[model samples]
Target: MAHQTRIPKLASILAVSALGLSLSPSWAARSFTPQAGTWVISDEVDGKPGRGFAIDVQGNTFFMQVFGYEKNGDATFYAATGQMEGDTVTAPLLRYQGGRSFGSEPRDAQEDKSIGDVKLSFRNGLQGTMQLPGEPAKDIERFIFTAPDAAYYQTEQWKTSSRMARWFGLNAQGQVEKSWFAMLKTSPTEPMRLTLSDGQTSETLECSLTTPSDSIRCVAANAADAGQAPVVKEAQFRLLGAQVAGAVSLQAEGAAPLQLLGINTRADYPYSGGVIVGCCANGLESFMPGTFGYAQRPAYQPSNGTWVMDDELTGKPGRGVSLDVQGGKMVMQVFAYRADGQPTFAMGVGDFAPDPELRDVSSARFSLQQYRGGRSVGGAASSGELVRDEGEVMVQVSGRTGGYGMPAGSLAEAMVQFPGESAKRMRRLPLQPWQTLEDQLFGEWYFPGLSYAGRPLTVTLNRREGEFVTNDDGSVRCQFNTQMLRGECQWPTATGTSGSSGPIELQDAFALSNSYVRLRDRYGNLVGLGQVPLN
Candidate 1:
C-alpha cells in the first residue's frame, strides 16, 4: 500500500511540474482578456465623473473605444487595440473605423497620429497610472468596468454618489419638469435606441454602441423640437443599464454648456489674456470676407495683476486701453490720439459688486463714462458710456460674444457708432475641433432677383419642427409630397395667393452645401443650387 501511494504522489508531482513549466514567461506574456463592459471612471483629483474604457477581447488582445469630455473641458475620443498581461495593459491608439474592421492590420504610427500609445501597470481594482504620450502620467482611481446592468444600478447606491446625480441630470429637474429620455430595444440583438422628447417632437437615434455586449457613448443628436427641421437637441447619457437613467436638454451655442453629467460639456472655456482697450473703435472681428475681416486688432497683455491694452500701430492714430479691478471698484480708461499726435483720452470709473458666495455667478454692471474724446478723428466717431451687464465672467464671455474682442479687450466693443452693423449682428464661437453641425442648416432660402407671375416676389422655405413649408410671398410654386419622412415640405394651396404662380412639385427639396442648406425645386434647379443662399 505504501509503495502504491509513493507512485501516485510521484505522478502528481510530475504533473504539477509540467503545468508550472508551461506557464513560464512565454505563456505569461501572451495576453489577458478582461470582461468587456462599460467603465465609469474618475479620480480623487476633483471627484468628477466620466465614462470610460469600452473594450472587446479576442484570443490574445483587446480592441478599445473611449469617448468623453476631459478635465480641461476638451473632448477625447478614439479607438485602439491593446494587450493585457496580468495587470499590465499596453496599446497604441488607432483610427476609428465603423462597424466593419480589418483587425489584422499592423498599427500605423503615421496614419494614427492623433492618438498616442496607451500603457499602464495596475494594482487591484484596475487603478493605476495611465502613461499616455504628451500628457503627464494621469492617476486613475477606482477605475473599473461594469456591465450596463451593473449591481450598483439596481440598488440606490449610484444615485447617492456625489456628482453622479448631476452627471445623469437629476439636478435638471429644478429647471424643467418634462425632461424625458428612454432606452429602447428595437430588435433582440440590434443596437439599442436612445429617444429624447422635447415636447413638440422627438428625436430617435441608435446608441453609439458597436457591440451588443456592453457599451456607452458621448453623443449629440438632432431633436425635432418646436423649431424647424434642422433644430438640434442634445443630451448626454450612458445608453444602457438596469438603473433608471436621467438626462437634460443641452443649452444652445451662445449659452453656457449644460453639464453632460460626467463629461465637461461647458461650451465656453476660459482663456487667459491681458487687458482690453478701445479708444476710437471697439475692434470686434468682422465676419465679412474681405478687408473688414482682415483689419488689425489691438493687442493686450497682463501687467502685474491688471491688464494693458494697446493698439501698438506705430503711426496709425487710435486709442490705448487700461483696465483694472481693485477691491470691488473697476476702471476702464481709453487713451486716444490724433494723427498729429493730439490726445483725446477717455476714462470710465465704476463700482462692481462682487459676490462673496457663488463668485462664478457674480454679476457686474457698469456704465463707462466718457471723460473725453468728443471729436471725430480720421473719419471715425468716438464717445459713449458703455454699460457692461453684471454676470459671471465666464457667462458674459459666451452670452455676449463678438462684442468684446476675445476678452483681452475689444477696441470697438464700447464704441457705439464706429462699428454699427458688424458688432450688432456678429456671433462668434470659441474654436473647437469637435463639431456640432445642426445650426448650419437653418435660416432663409434666397433665390435672388425673381418675379413670379410677372409680379415682384420672394420665395422662401420654412422648416419648423418636423414640418417644411413653402412660403412664397410672390407667384412661386409650392407642391410637396405632404409626407414628413418622404423628404418633402409643406405644399402651396391650389388657389394662388395674390403673387402665387406655378405649383412646382419637389422631391428631397432640401439640399446641403457643406455647412449651408438649400431649397432644391424648379426654382432651385433653374437658379442653381449653389446660387441659392440661406441668408
Candidate 2:
C-alpha cells in the first residue's frame, strides 16, 4: 500500500462598500463604471495595506474582486470576489461568490466557507471602500485607480535598475512571517501614510519621501516621542533586487536597530538574479517588456558560439530576432534583415553558458520602452535568467493594480525568435540542446527529506568520481563516476538490498530541481532508487 503524503494548505480570507447616490429607475438604464482603472490599495483601518481591489457594474448588479494580504495570520493572499443587487454596491456575507489564496493550495478550510457581511461604496467614481455591514470598526479600506505605476520610469529604484522587490511586515520579536507587499504610488508632494498591522496591534505613521542624489528616503512625518506623530515601532524590508547592494533592515528606533544579513524567509529562494525564476504567469495579462523596467536575456558563451537567426517571421522588426553579444554586453541598436532586404530593429532572447570563471555570459536583462504616437501611456518589463533545457525563463513583472499578480506570478507574453528556423519565437524560451548542469552538481548534497527515514543518504559527486553513503550504521558505500554507476557498495544485490550499480546513467539530467534522478543497475535498469531525493 502506498503511503498518503500530506500537502501544505493556506489559511486566508477573501473580500468590499458606500456612497448615497441617485437610486432611480433610469439608473438601471444608465451605465455606471469606475472613472479610472488600476485601483491600488491606498489605506486600511484595522487591516493590512498592499491590498488592491476592483469593481465592475452591470445593470442592477455590481461585481468586485479583492486582492493582497489580509489581516488573517496567513502570510499569503486572501483574495475574494462578490456581487450585490438592486443598484447598491453592498452585499451580505453570503453574497461573496468565490475566492482563492495565493500561497499554499486550498485544502477545504472553513475560512473559505464563512464570510461576514460587506458594505461597498465609490466616491467620484475613482475611489472605493470595503467594510463590514453597518459598523465601521470591522474593516475599512481604500483603493485608488488614478495612482501611477511608481516602480517604473518615475521612481529612483526603477531608474537604478532596482526593479525586483519583495517586502513583509515584521513583529516585535523581530519576525516577519507573513509578507506585506507594498507596491505603492505615493504623492510626491504630500505626506504618505502607512498602516502597519500585526494582527493584534497597529500603528499609523505619516512618512515623508525625500530624494537625495536620486535615492528615495522615507522619514517619520513627526519626530519620535515628541508630538501626535506615531512612531514606526517595527518593520522589516529586504530590498534584494540591486546588482551591487542589497539589505534586510529592521528600522525601529528603540527596538532592534540591527542591519542584519542571512536568510529572511523560510525558503531562501535566490532573490538576486543568481537564481532565475520561472515565467510568473497567473494575473498580469497585459504586460510588455522594456516599457517599464529592463527585460533580461540569459545566455552562456559557447566559446566560439554564434547567434542563429529564426527568419520565419517577415513582419515588422522581422517578427523574429536574436541579439549579438560583445564583452558580455549588447549594443544599443539591434536590427535584422527582412525578406525584402530591408533591415528592421530585431529584439529577442537566447540562453547558453560557458563558465562563470572564464566569462559570465549566462544572462542578459533588457527593458522595452513603448511609445504610442510618441506619448507614453504606461510600461512593463521582463527578466531572463539561466534556466534548464525544459528550459524557460518565465518573466512576469509583478504589480498590484491592473491584476499584476496571480497564483504563479502575473501573465504577459511576447514571442521572440531564437537560433533555428524551426526554433520559433517564445517569451519562455528553453535552450534544452545547450544546457549543462554537470559542473553545477559537483559538490556534496545531503537529502534533507530522508533524514527522518530509517536510512538517510549522503551524496558526494565530482567531475571524476563520487560516492553515496548510507548514514545508518555506515553500512553502505557506493562509489560511481561518469563512466561507472557503482564502484563499490556493501551488501550489494543481497535479498532486500540496493541493486548492483552498472554503467552510470542520469535520467532527465538537466532537471536537478526535480530532485534525485533514476539510479539504474549494471544492465541499465531502475534500482528502486528513483524518486530517492524527494522520497
Candidate 3:
C-alpha cells in the first residue's frame, strides 16, 4: 500500500467549555488535573495549521475535539476511553465522528503529560468506515495519519534529553518498517548533509548545495563536471516543534519583515510569488515575501507599510485610474479620456461610479476581456497574471522541504495581452492572459473547493523542453532550465455555455482559459518577463 498521511493544522484551541458528568468516583480519589487548555500541532504536509480541543475527564478519560480540516476545510471530532497511569495515557476510541473508526476499533490517545522512560507507539490507520456528514461511511481511500514518525510534542523547546528519550507523542504510524530524513541549507558555501536512521541501521548522504554564483566561480570544473552541482531547493521535516528563524529577499521592492511568531510549521508550502503558511501551526494560509521568526510564541510585530502607484492611470477612450495602497486599503482616482489622449477622469483618488464595462463586479472570480498585447499597465490591480511565453515573472519562495521556509516572501504579478493589440492603447487595461509563477506569483491562490476558481485544476508546472511538467515529488530537479507556471482558467460560460453569458456562478462554470504563466530557471529561481507600466 501507499503511505497514509495527515496534513497538520496549527489551530489553537480558542476555548473549551465542558459540562458533563463528574469523573468515576474511583478517579476523583487520585490527584488528577483534567487539563483543558490548548495544544497545537503542525502538519508538515500541507503547511497549513490544524486545531482541536483536548479535554481530560477525571484524569482518566481523554477527549480530543478536532475543529480544523484539510485544505478542503472539513472538520472531525473523536473521543477515546483509556486510563492515565502516571504521566503516560493511552486511550482507545469509544465514540468518534468524522474520524477513522472500525466496528469497535479505538482511536489514538492524547497525553499532555509525559513519562520519564516513555516509548510511546501511536497507530492511526484508514482501516475503518468513515463519512463526511452527507457522504456515506466508507473505507477512506488514503490514510495520511499513518506516518510512523509523526509523534506529537517533539517541539523545538524540548531539550536534548526529551528528544533522545522520545518523550513526545506520535500522531500516526508509517508503513515503512524504518524511515529516516536529513536536513540541509540552500546556499552554495553552506555545508549540508542528509542522515537517515532506521530503528537499527543508519545512513548519511552528503553533497554540496550550490547557487548560480558557485557555478560561475568554478567554470573550470563546469567543463569536466559530471553535471550541475545538486542545489538544495526545497526540504522539510517534523520538528515535534522547533525554533526556526527565516527570511525572504528579492530584487524588486516591497519585501520587509512580517514579524510572525508562534507558528506551527505544518501547512507550509512554496507558491508562485510567496509562501503559504499557518501560525501556531494551527490553520493553513499564505505569507507575502519578507522575513519571519518561528517558535512557541510571537517573535515580533508588523509595521504599517504602504506603497502608491508611480503614475496616474488615465481611462481608456479616456485616461485610466490613479491608485494608492496604504495600511491594506486601496485608493483610486478616475480621469476621463480627452481628444488629445489627456487625462479625462477625475484626478487624485477621484470618487465616481466605477466603470460600467467592468462586468460581474460582486463575483469572487472575474475574467479579463482582452488587453492590447505587449503593454505594461501600471498599478497593483493592473498587475495581473505573469506569463511564461514572454518570460517576465518567476517563482522565488519554497516550502520547508529544503529548509527554505514557506512564510513571508515577495508578492508581484503581471498580465499579458492578445498579439494583435497596440502597445500604447493596451497599457490602459488590467485584464490579460495567462499567469506565471514569478517572484510576484509568490503569494497564493485559494479555492473554496477541490480546485482553484472552479475551472482547470491549477498546478505549478516546471517547463521541461518548451513543455510543462508537474512537480509530483514537490521538488524541482531539472538538468536544464525550467519555468514554474501557476495555471488557472477563466470561466467563460456555464454548465454547457461557451462565451461571456454562459455561467453565473464560479463553482464549476469556468471554461478553459489561461490566467497567467510565470517563468523560472531549472533551479526554480524566478526571472522577470518585462517591466510593468506604472503610469
Candidate 4:
C-alpha cells in the first residue's frame, strides 16, 4: 500500500488559498471601481454560498458569471450577463443554466452580445454590492482577485468536497427532513457528484444551484415550481484561489423566511498564471470503466480469466477485473506480488458504489476481496459515498491493510439491481451524439401518447421531417428527407384499417414530432401515440 499524505484541518484555507480572490480595498467605502481583468464576487446567505466572476474590458464593458447552490447542493443556480458603462450599470435579469427554476415560459430573446450598463462600487475593504431587476437596493457581496494566489497559484488544479441537502417536502411529523446530503464537484462545466454519509442511512441525491440569492432570482432550467412558494436558507462561503472568492446557498418559497448562510474570504498568493489544476479526494472515485457506454470483449471464457490492468486502474492495484452484479453492490479483489510470483504488497479489495449512469434501467453495487492463492486477508472493510443525479450514482472507495504482500492474481465482481419502488424519479436525460439525429427526426413522435385528448390510438412511425401532414379523414401523412408515406393511423379518438392506398390531404399543421398530429378534425376525437423510431 502507498503511504497517505497528512491532510490539514478544515479551518485552514491553505489548499485553495491562491484560488481565492481578494476584494478591492475600497469595499469599506461602499464605492466600487471597476477593474480591467478577471475577478470574482462571492455572497453568503443563511448557510449557502454563491460565486460570480467578471471579465472587464477597456473600462466600458464587463461580462459576469454567477453560480449559487442550496444547502443540499442539488439546488444549483448560475447565469451569465454583460454590463456596460452608463449613468448606472443596468444589467439584464440573470438566468440559470442546467438548473430548474425558470418556469416553462420560453426564455427572453435577448442575445449574449447585447451589453448593458452594470455599475460596480465597493462597500468596504472586503465587501461590495450590486443591483439586478427585482432588487430594491443593491445586492451585497465580497470581491476577490484570483491571479495572485500562493497555493492555487502554484497548483494548476484542485478539488474541494462539500455537502448538499435537497429540501423536497416536509414529512408527516412536521420536522424538516432532507434527502441524503450529496457530494458536489465543481469544475467549469464538468461537475462530479460525490457521496454524503448521514451516520445511519446513506442515500444519494442530486445537487445544484437554484438562484444567486433570494433577492435576485436567476433563470433556472425547469420551472415547475414557479409561482409556487419560496424557500428560506442562508448562504455560505469558502475561498478557493488567490484573489478569488466564492459562496453557496439555498432559496425557497412559502412558510419559512429566506435564510442566507456564512460569508468569509482570505488573501491569496501572487500571480502564477498557467493552467488551473483540479482536485480530488480519496473518498471519491469514478464508476465508469475506462470510457463510458458499452465495450465488447470475448465472453468470460473461464481459463481466459487472465486479468490485466487498464490505464483507468492506474497507480497501484495488480491485474484489474470487471464484473456485473444486479443492482445491490459488488466486491472485487486484487493481489500484488513480486516478479517471482511471491506476494509483496498486501492484497487489496475495491467496493464500487451503485452505478448512477444506469440507475434508471438498473442499479449496481461493488465489493473487493483480497486473497493469496485463495486465502482471505481478513481485514478488508471499505466505505463509499453515492453522488446521485436523478437516476445514476457514483461511488468512491478507500481500502486498508495491516501488512499484506503483492500476489499474482486479482478479481472484481459487480451487482446491478432494479429498485422497483425505491428508485428516484427518472429525469429525461440529454441525448447521446448519435441519438441527436434520431431525436430530431423523431422529435414529437408519440405512440399511445398521454397528453392528447379523447380516445387514444396507437400510431406507428414511418418517416418524419418538419411538418407532420395529417389527412381530413384522420390519417397520418409523414415526410422524410425526400420520401413520403401514408398510413391509416389512429390517435386517441378513432382507429382505422392499415392501408397504403389514398390521396392524402396533408394539413397545414407540420409535424415537429408525431406526438399529436395537429389536424383540423371537423368531427373526430384525438389521441396520440408515443414516439418511436422510423426504422
Clashes of each: 21, 29, 109, 160
What is the RMSD of candidate 2?
29.3
lDDT of every predicted structure (CA atoms): 0.27, 0.25, 0.20, 0.22
Candidate 4 lDDT tens digits, 1-535: 1100111000000000011122112211111123211233332222111222322211122333322222232211122223333213345433222111111211111111212234444332233456432232344432221212323222323233232222111223222233222233433344423233223333222334322221112222221233442222332222221111122233444434211111111111112111111110111122337775222110100010112222222222122221111111121112122233222111111222222342211222322211122111111211111122122221221111101121111011112111111211111111111122222222222232222333223233434333543433335544322222222233333354443422121110111111123211111111111111111
Model 1 lDDT, full chain set? 0.27
lDDT assessment of candidate 3? 0.20
Candidate 1 residues lying further than 4 Å off, grouped into runs, are: 1-33, 44-51, 69-76, 97-114, 141-535
RMSD of each: 27.4, 29.3, 29.4, 28.1
| lDDT-superior candidate, 3 or 4 | 4
Off by over 4 Å in 2: 1-165, 168-179, 193-212, 220-254, 258-280, 284-413, 417-423, 427-535
Candidate 1 per-residue lDDT, tens place, 1-535, comes to 1111111000000000000111112333211123222222233222222223433332234344443322332222344444445556677653321111011111111122335686665442223456554545656432222333434233232222111111222222221123223333233345445455433455655554333333334244554556545222444343221122223344455533332212111111012111111111122232335554312221211110111112222222122233333222333333322223222223333433322232111123343222222111111222222223221121111111223333222211221111111221111111111122221222233232342453222334533332234454423323333332122222244564334322221111122111111322221221110111001
Give TM per candidate: 0.20, 0.24, 0.18, 0.19
Best by TM-score: 2
Range of the 10 consecutive residues with the lowest summed lDDT in candidate 2: 1-10
Report lDDT (Cα) of residue 74, candidate 1.
Answer: 26
Off by over 4 Å in 3: 1-61, 64-78, 81-83, 90-93, 96-184, 187-535
